[model samples]
Target: MPLLFLLRLQHIPLPVRVALSEEVRLVSVLVATGLIEADFAPVRPTGPDAASRIATVKRITEEGLAEIAKMSDAPKFAKTSMRFARGLRLM
Candidate 1:
């Protein structure tokens, strides 16, 4: 989910950004609780090839977002609490 936030803040490919956004919406509660986890593999060129390594990084990011969605949901209590606070002008 932090990846999603960073993607939204940077100039990245639209499709990748959109995928991240959708994943974030699907797992916002885990994000709010700071429970999302992402594994960033180290980049190593196998045969003087760098482009494929970059693609691997992108794929890893997408997979991480998918895992987050599968593990989280929007927390109902947090939403309701925020609404109640706003009603009292304490937000």
Candidate 2:
């Protein structure tokens, strides 16, 4: 399966983030329902190996959140990206 980059963008700890990403499709779904072992497959190398990956995702998310906060009253640039994605359906 493809790695879901978006799935890792939460403000929690590394292990917990990886634990969530391994199975859930979106963070909202994870938050609304809560994490269960059955909800996510067990992450391998459970000790410290997955830490950096999770940390990087967390840092990126924090940066994104900072940027979004600065634009709280503006339309997000993401709307153009979404529009382009929809346009792709016609090509």
For TM-score, the strongest prediction is 1
Query: lDDT of each structure?
Result: 0.41, 0.39
Lowest-scoring 10 consecutive residues by lDDT in candidate 1? 51-60
Give the per-residue lDDT digits (tens) of candidate 1, residues 1-87: 454554342344433322233443433433344443322233454554332212111323444455545534446657888889888
Query: Tens-digit lDDT track for model 2 on 16-68?
Result: 44433443444333333332221233345666534222211223344445444
Model 1 alpha-carbon drift over 4 Å, by segment: 5-52, 57-67, 70-78, 87-91
> Candidate 2: RMSD over Cα atoms?
12.5
